[model samples]
Target chain A: MTQTKIDGRAKTREIKRKANLNLLERLYLPEIFKGLSITFRQIFKPKFTFEYPDVKWQPPASFRGRPVLVVDDETGVERCVACGLCARVCPALAIEVVADETELDKERYPKKFEINMLRCIYCGLCEEVCPEEAIVMSKEYELVFTSREEAIFGKDKLLTPASKLKDRLEFLRKMR
Target chain B: MESILIAILKAIIFILLFLTFSAVLTYVERRISAFIQDRLGPNRVGPFGLFQPIADVVKIIFKEEIIPANADRTLHTLAPIISLFVAYSVFAVLPIGEKLVIDGKEIKLVLADVNVGFLYILALSSLGVYGVTLSGWSSNNKYSLLGALRASAQMISYELSLGLSLVGVVLVSGSIQIDEIIRSQANVWNIFYQPVGFIIFLVSVFAETNRLPFDLPEAEPELVAGYHTEYSGMKFGAFYLAEYTNIITASLLVTAFFLGGWYFPFVDIYSGLNPNLSAILQVIVFFGKASLIIFLFMLVRWTLPRFRYDQLMRLGWQVLLPLALLNVLVTGLVKILL
Candidate 1:
């Protein structure tokens, strides 16, 4: 408390003194005219407003919007190895995975994969923990759901073609 | 009989014109303020948001009228009506143009050609205090009462300088009639002759209209919404309309008194032009000048920050009053000597 008090006093002493005004500046009318001219000029300056609904902003690859599962273009199948690491690492406990035996080369598949989007905090922890690089954040931020059940995104809604997620995957690789 | 009919017709037309002008003024003020602040204001309602005021009126009319349970109902209802009445009535004596000769009969371009137009305006504008005061008192809200008190005090203080400043014009013109005052400025504007008086009047007019730098009555930060805090729905709309109407009236008064109403400088009015054509041109010129003053009012509002209550009172009583008295004294002396 004593240290802070001394610092506060020093801070007060360090404050810059305001410049004294001359006779013309003290009159106020001239200064008002000066201010008015400034504002008048500002009226012709380019406005910074975005008509939101008419022109949607396209987020960059670095933007972490909503998480989705990536599907390989050649195989037409999700890249998930059903490792359950994402489910374990998710702080929100939003992800769920049920692994089962598969005939495919991966030898394991997710019988059930779902993400409760409402519970998602968009921390990208699931994406970071995934070994197979199955899940990544997409640029789909406008998430609206009428019911709680509808907010639980199943595999069908979570899957996105790899071509659409090229930017995020490339960005992740570069960052890594 | 026909003269009375014409007078009534003229009053109706002027009232409609004022109402429309006030609405458009709101849109213009919003758009200009937005531009100054680097934003696009209300552009969706119509072309360049021209119909925004119409939409606002519709929305306000349909809103739920909320009155405090402990409020005085009668006074609450009467308050806005009083405000609207005072605002509309003040425009009656303001002449827009010179006389027009139609069908061998000369018709004056004023709703009422009363000789004491100056005093009439002062008296009516003073009466506007009742609407604000009564509304504040009847609302039973602390903020509203404080706002009302500030309004009344401010008006009383500034009205002195306002009247005294205009006294210089009355001295020069030798009449309390507004049209006569305008006529006296045919040679040179009052702004040139009575520059000090014009400044005093201009400042007082800002205070009188409760505009910024003198808008303690409706200081949103201190008072919730000032005297109109408790008002809602079309009742609130009435106060809003009255406020803008006062702005228009003040602008017109400034233009007529200082800027030389209906007189285009360096353009001889009697220079071989048709009387009707000249009259129409004069009316257009008068409105154009008034519009410029109104634009100035809006610009000043956006430019200046509100003064502290103490600062406002000090400026009104100590500064403006003294200057106005000196202006009147000088004008009187000059008139007597010259």
Candidate 2:
């Protein structure tokens, strides 16, 4: 503790010494003027920025984006088997599942699945944990709105129909 | 009736001038700092975002003015008005542009050619602390009161050095009138002769204005919103306006004292020009110097971190006060000897 206090005072004196040096430098003024000149030049230089909304930026291929549930095209239904794997894998405890025995060929499916997007850490472990090729993480990142209800992606919001997979895949392909 | 009309016109001109300059200074302070820090600031509104100030004005005008129920109603309303008035009134003594000749009748550049212009400026500027202090105290909040106390003490402490630093100029020029001081520096600017006094004066101005590096009163992390914690809408805007006006006033004073007012660099070449043209040139030159000084203020703000309240007080009492006094003493001796 004594050593830290001594070190702090020493640092302060060093700072004062530097300040004196700066004062000496300002006595010449030309050196400071030169620095100002460089800043003035860069002030007018064209800024490097891309237009957003109209032109979306493409992130790297390994970039994880929004999470979505996969659908079976041949069966014309969701591929999820009500296994509760997604809920278990989510580190944030963001995902919740409510499975029920449905009349879709008597296979069990989620009756009421809810994922709180605010709590979601976007870990993509949900996709990895799904037994049947049911969940997939897509590259659709710009998700924002006013209401809390809108932010929470339910089973209806998470389950991207089979028809939309082709468009999502095309966007992903173009990003590369 | 004619004198009253002229006086009314003069008041109108000065008030409009102060408000307009303060508005534009808000834009300039932001833009200049951004430039120094290598970033573009406010370039999306009007051409180069010149209308950003106008947009700010509109926003402030339409904003909901909130008054806390527990707060003192009269002082809360009066605080910003007092700040705005004191700040705005100081500009009457400040000469902005070149003298104009209308119908061969010569009119001076300054709004009011007060004989004791320097004293007027110092006295009015000191009054600005009251507005800040009252707002803070009347808020019935501890943070606001603390901020106000810091502000009042800081302004009062710095006012001494600020006044003393300029004492050297008053001693050398032998005139409290700003125009006369400008006239004294017609040959060589006072800055060249009394650089130490100028430096001391600049530092004190920074402290007195409660700007960055001396902005301990409103240190956002420490004091939250400071004295204006409960202020909103035009009340908040008034506080902001007062600050910008103070900056402009400091810049003008610096220009009038250190830099020759409206005196162009190559006046020898322009000496052959018509008297009217010469005056116009001088006005532009004056404003150019003031603008550069304002730019420097913005630059230093971005470059330096704020001083702690204790450090600022110590610097004022221990360092700047003595230095300013010494400058006056030395200048006096030199004036007597020479």
Residue lDDT tens for model 2, A6-37? 56456332222444556657554466466556
Model 1: chain B TM-score vs. truth?
0.98
User: Native contacts retained per candidate?
Assistant: 0.91, 0.20
Give residue B122's error in model 2 in angstroms: 1.6
Model 1, span B50-104: residue lDDT tens:
8999999999999999999999999999999999999999999999887889899
Q: Candidate 2: which stretches are off by over 4 Å?
A: A1-55, A69-84, A87-121, A131-134, A144-176, B35-39, B266-270
Q: Write the per-residue lDDT of candidate 2 for residues B1-338, one digit (tens) a residue.
A: 86467667878877786788788888987787676655677877799999999999999999999988889999989999999899888888887654667677677777788999999999999999999999998888888899899999999899999999999999888899988898888788888888988988998999888888788778888999888988899999999999888888888899898777666653443457776787777767776788888887776666567788888898899888999999989999999899
Instruction: List the global CA lDDT of all models.
Output: 0.92, 0.81
State the DockQ of every prediction.
Answer: 0.85, 0.26
Indicate which candidate wins on DockQ.
1
